[model samples]
Target: MNGHADVGPLTSLDLRLQWRAAATADLADWAALIARTAAVERPVWFERRADLEQILASKKNPAAANTILGFDPEGVARACGRITRNPEGEKAIGFGCVDPGWQGSGIGTGLLGWMEARTRQRFAADADAGADGGSGAAPRLRLHMEQQHTHQAALFGDAGNRIVRYFNEMHRPLQDGFPEAVLDGGLELVTFGPRLHEPVQLAHNEAFRDHWGSEPRNEEGWGFVVNDPLARPDLSAVVVERASGRVADYQLASHDAGSAESRGYAEGYTDLLGVQREFRGRGVAQALLADAMRRFAAAGMDKASLDVDSETPTGALALYAKMGYVAVSTSMVWDKDL
Candidate 1:
């Protein structure tokens, strides 16, 4: 995609603001910016170009304006960010980073302001078109930042955002044997496959309905996960009810051995885990997790990781702790009403 027609000037930092829809060509620069920013903020964080590419591809609507890039006078990328609106158009998710060398130079703040403005303008137009189906309520702007990154938290806080929720990145070593998949009668454990996508998607939406700030997953969002190159369909687990033959719970696993952010470790990430409301009391959730962990171990992964809402109503944090997972990092979701 081409850069936005109007290239605004950021005279203070000798940088020009360019609003652009991200393309495959920008993956390398985006990955580099993510790596550099992570190194300076959270050294353990790792991002891959392929991951970014998959996300951009999932947007599907090529005409949607969602990305902004800032460049130095020398044509070098100095900062970048993107805004993603939920299918319901009630929320906008944003994230961006400034070059390590350019921190404290107002570049990061300027980029955030630009993104927020863009989000507001887009949502305003959608509102005028009755895009929200006549809700007429203003959309909320949301952004996530590592709790340890006080500077980022401060920057957003200064802009009137408040911490709305916290999430923990939990990890567990796989050297120990994983628990055997234990399922109650009439529940069968199976691997993810083509026919199970829709059922799994519906179950996921139902499971996350009570989650903070959760939006139902649309077709494009579901496609993004299943179509990801790194997604291990064979390694992912799905628990189905025998009577109705429907997916009750699922665990989607992914791994990229070549990811520089992984720090050379063979890590299997449980991208999404969900259990339908009716299946909560049963052992379906635990069974799906155990089967996933077993698959990761069979793949010779050194560890497994996943993120959970710290205040999940399902007591997920406590459940994970009981399963030998420990918090490795913490992040907060900040929100501002638009």
Candidate 2:
């Protein structure tokens, strides 16, 4: 995407604003800014631009704008946020970040204001054209931030939004090894190979649709995932009916050996765990979690961690609790009306 456009002639903080859609060309600088901020603020893992590009590729195109990069009166890109239409056509905005030097200077507030106006205008125009189908647009917006990020919480709250959910970052020490549990008769747990990738991805996409603020993962998402070199297909576990060749439930685990963020030691992570709706309450989640923990332990990793939306309709908190995963940290969601 192009860099922030010039803010010609205006010098006031509010009047000096200019923004432009982020393009692939800006990925290097954008990723660098994000990486630097992440290192100082969270320092959990390595943030590679390539991985982000892959993830972004899996998503659907935005209705109007994909991302907004903000600039000062001097024409410098310093802040950014993303806006996209969810599966239900609800416009969601998230991943807002401002440079540390520019914090508290009203830049973030300006960006939010711009987003609000843009959101309402787009919704109104769509509504007028009968494109809204008379659904009476709600103009939804969502954001996720670390729990301790009080400044961001204040920013969104001041903008007239409330915390809808608090997601917990859970971790278990993997270097200590995972306990193997014997399954009762007729309840066999199996780890499937690449052959089960599509079915498992579909099951997860369906299960996550009911999740809070989640958009359905399209076929392109599965295609990107199947071709991803980072994904360990053999390390994934899929719950089986034993007699039938059907996948009742599944969970995916990934490892970044060199990055401390992936392993929970200021690096490394084991993320992406989901269970099919039909397979809930049958110990499928636990089985898959345990299997992932085992794989992480075998890899000689120090820790395994993942984030879960505590307000999830699936009672995930209780499930994770039962599996011995505890909260290491938390994040809050911020939102506002245009």
Candidate 3:
């Protein structure tokens, strides 16, 4: 796979802009460019430079190499995008943001095409290396857009991508006192700790196996999430089945001050919440969520936020609603078979 074309001039753009693969040195500018995109749409959440670093941590493709940036003559970033092909790659996920000024000038379309090609390139590299071609299903390139931004959805539609799924960003005010985690049967709730790291990762893979676009987390990728600087083990909890000492369910939570900057109150987030198939209807999730919410309140957070698949058969949306979480925003997942 030729990686050279990954970065260069953007002659396709209607405006004068240069496209180049990002480097560690460009993270600050890369993040600033995305913030500008969000600022134009809704300044509700912001990602700190560190967050981008954590997201782009990879052995196969370093943060700098896996990301691309579009800059104007002044050396200012006007667009940014990243590509991630998970180990169990049924899908290659593409994330992008364009400067509001450059939105209508073909930057979005150009960036999407670049990522799609990069996805193909990555998969070809894997096949060349004799890696298992992942489920032997047709490869797909996926992109997500906030539902409020119909224009972004239209962009994907114009690119031949189809709506594959929907997701909701839900928030819960830390009012109404937090509830103590209570599990029936032989289940016990405990704070996530060092010893449980790999176990939790393994459990997460099983727990989410049936969910849409879910991919098994390879050790390196799992480490990125488990060891994130913003991760709060104190706020995360796992439900264990005492008899077999198996992880019945888990809630992985984090606090990102940068994300809550626009809000009047501090926010803690449930980054991942999963329940083993056997434990789904037995209250494992409820207990973990309650435990996380309690910890968040104790940590002085004024609200809790989580993103959930709208079409999950696990009834997560209803449960979250039952627990007082309400949809604040929505995002749509679109995919184009590669």
Candidate 4:
């Protein structure tokens, strides 16, 4: 029997809600559903099975089950949701999507409600286990949606979620060429290598600590980055502090060949860019971006893309703008106390 067999039916449709924990076999179906939904909800975005696999493998809190699928009586995956708790269990990140055909039929809302309840239950268990014993407030629940999905945003709003953050999906045309990267006196640039993965991961966590909704990555999460088949280590760069010989900043890049082909242009993606707090103002970020652009150009890519918070403390959006990146799309983060 399906896990959600006992759940009530969706009011607007004849579909009975059936729940199940996602397994390795579900990757293809999940990717297919995401693609089908994105074709209408977010045409510019691409979802891949590898990415889904990585997400499933990188569950931060193993004891807190998060992946839940809502299926129809016919065993079709009509909706899915996942909630990932941070290490401290003080915050949980939630995301879900409904099959476009069933979107307005209330599957999305039902999935979200189920995810919220599951998250709360997990948080309560964590609290009882002394994981979040000291904090008096309930864990924060957050979800992200593309800004263009106004209807979905309205639904989330009606469900008591408020906008908390906005992110710009920025793109730069590499065919136009790029400026020379200037490194400060105390910093040295090095190509990404297997040896630098651990240090880079540590520096990334440190750098992103102050960012809103940021969470430190564990080994599994870090592995998802380094082990990804699309990662172009040769095109990526890391800046090391000459004095301390520590990773001060880094850029991890990837080449999405399918996406590039779909768009009729070769493109490189800047998957992650982070600079240590103490090294922020020393031109580290600009240098890293320039290096990535240069590499993309050399690789015959027509464009490079990355996403940044609009309200980033590091002025990342402005910096990307200065580097000739333009906003192609925007996504919003919705949050509520759970």
Candidate 5:
């Protein structure tokens, strides 16, 4: 019943399902719908029900206003869509999936139109209120989908959205020993601590400031990362400049039991990795990744994984390759000018 197996034009609208803004009460239904899609396209990446609950609670994507769900007569969610509002950013990012049984029914197309309109409205409201300094740039709608979802390519194409960038999911086995990485003479390595959360966030913003599509995360957006219920501080690593005690690089790691069980292998993930602009060329990233792999191995994980922009300006893809990671899957960004 996965709609992803076949894709069609958005001409037919399935009006049997009732559409409404998401609510906390719909968490179970929405998560089930998400799981169905993940199984068909991205089995290694599934969101646990609790994770969906936490997402519903996020201010930037609150269930009450920013998210929508389509429910059938039996009250089962059949389609879902939402936009992540980064007020300071020039793009509105969307995340959604249609129910497996309803892929070619035009529900996804209808959901996409709603999302595009919703994004335009948000931009207009912000411009009128002079929010985020009103940078005067034309707003864009961006969405991410795995390359394996050929049906999505058709749907997005029909909607006038085109591929913008490619990303790779790289993974290295922990069953084998990790490479030895030494910190630079002026830098020291340390585990992530609660006291360093905000510092790490600041360093992250400064590090990825120039990376494509990376916008500075305000307090709430940053909160979504540091406050993750399964964040592994012991597995996370930070690099500090010895002389000034400045955070030069950081790698945040976490693992979920549900995801591991679904994939049939345990993995420790580098959710975020960043190097301060001043320290990019000092092998800081290599050292941090090596350090992360060792931690994952020690923590009994079977592998270590992270995603990278294929055309990243920093040559991160080569570095990760040198570190023994191999690209296992690809996800792409699609953009439509509004």
Candidate 6:
């Protein structure tokens, strides 16, 4: 039986399902279980549990009002997920995996249902105290999925949600090398700072404006960048408008040396590649990208990688395609109203 309508024999199954707020004690096992599972399943893009712990450490505190839940019984945590409030006042849910032996069981649905209910309860209680005003309605939840993972997609549809958007992961190999070009249109390429934090951040936010699925950057969003395990403050690049002295484009580069795929491979990643709205047709992005490739190549890297919204309004996917990146893998984002 689906966990939503009834808790079945699986509910009373051998493994007990318990819930608790994430704590220091469970951190290690939590990461291990997730890392091992991801390694076996989606090895290429799996995030180590240590990565989650670091994010949690930065977000958790006594004064903060947010929920990060853990589902586990005894020493094993077969599944994990989170519900967070973004700066835009939106509450979101991100969940993944069930112990292989327990796959057919109701644990996955149970955890998600519990999360939805818990979110409503918390938001409702806050509204009662006059913090948000009116009845506390549950916020919507969203998650990412592999485009080919239809079983997981159906699971959400069965629970009364709908697919929202498709997120694509695009890649390119620097091993094939980059194309050289002479500057045209009188535009100049410049590397501002390993020091201009505020400028780069502002330029990034401006560049992303009007793009599909784009959200404003704030302290919370910036937290994701600043605390990212792959975030290398020194390797970031921003393109400046020589005439106006304004940053018209920017890109952030970083690598995952710990990845098993990178054990002996010479590869780096072009993350957060963005070009400003007014600067689109000017070749600013390509210039910055070419410069970034040169930098990574100079650092002795064989390839560079990045992910793009195949449906981005700016036609970024085609831009990357023309620039020599190829589609290596794909993932989609699914969402439902709560």
Best-matching candidate per lDDT: 5
If scored against the real structure, what TM-score would every candidate get? Answer: 0.90, 0.79, 0.90, 0.89, 0.92, 0.81
Q: What tens-digit string does per-residue lDDT give for candidate 6 at 190-262?
A: 5545455677778877877777656656655666675678776555677776777677777787777776354
Off by over 4 Å in 1: 1-3, 6-21, 43-47, 58-64, 87-89, 259-264
User: Model 2: per-residue lDDT, tens digit, 75-115?
Assistant: 66577665544334566565567777778889777666656
* RMSD to native, candidate 6: 5.2
The TM-score of predicted model 6 comes to: 0.81
Q: How far is candidate 2 from the true structure (C-alpha RMSD, Å)?
A: 4.4
The deviation in Å at residue 117 for candidate 2 is: 3.2
- Which stretches in model 5 have alpha-carbon errors above 4 Å? 1-14
The lDDT for every candidate, in the order shown, is: 0.76, 0.64, 0.79, 0.79, 0.82, 0.63
* Local accuracy of candidate 5 as per-residue lDDT tens digits, 109-224: 88888678777767776778787586865778998888878899899999999999999999999877888888769999999998898888889999888899898878888787
lDDT of 4 by residue, 179-288 (tens): 67699898999999999989999999999988876777778778878988688999899999899899999999999787665578887899899989888888989999
- lDDT per residue (tens digit) for residues 61-133 in model 1: 3323666666666655668877777645577788788888888878777777766776676677677876666
The lowest-lDDT stretch of 10 consecutive residues in candidate 3 is: 1-10
Q: Runs in model 2 with CA error above 4 Å?
A: 1-18, 43-47, 55-59, 62-64, 71-76, 87-91, 121-136, 182-194, 221-230, 256-270, 312-315
Worst 10 residues of 6 by lDDT: 1-10
Ranking by TM-score: 5, 3, 1, 4, 6, 2
lDDT per residue as tens, model 3, 154-231: 899999999988888998888877655469979999899889999999999998889878888888888888888789
lDDT of 6 at 214: 63
Stretches of model 6 off by over 4 angstroms after superposition: 1-15, 58-74, 89-91, 121-138, 181-194, 260-266
Ranking 1 against 3 by TM-score, winner: 3
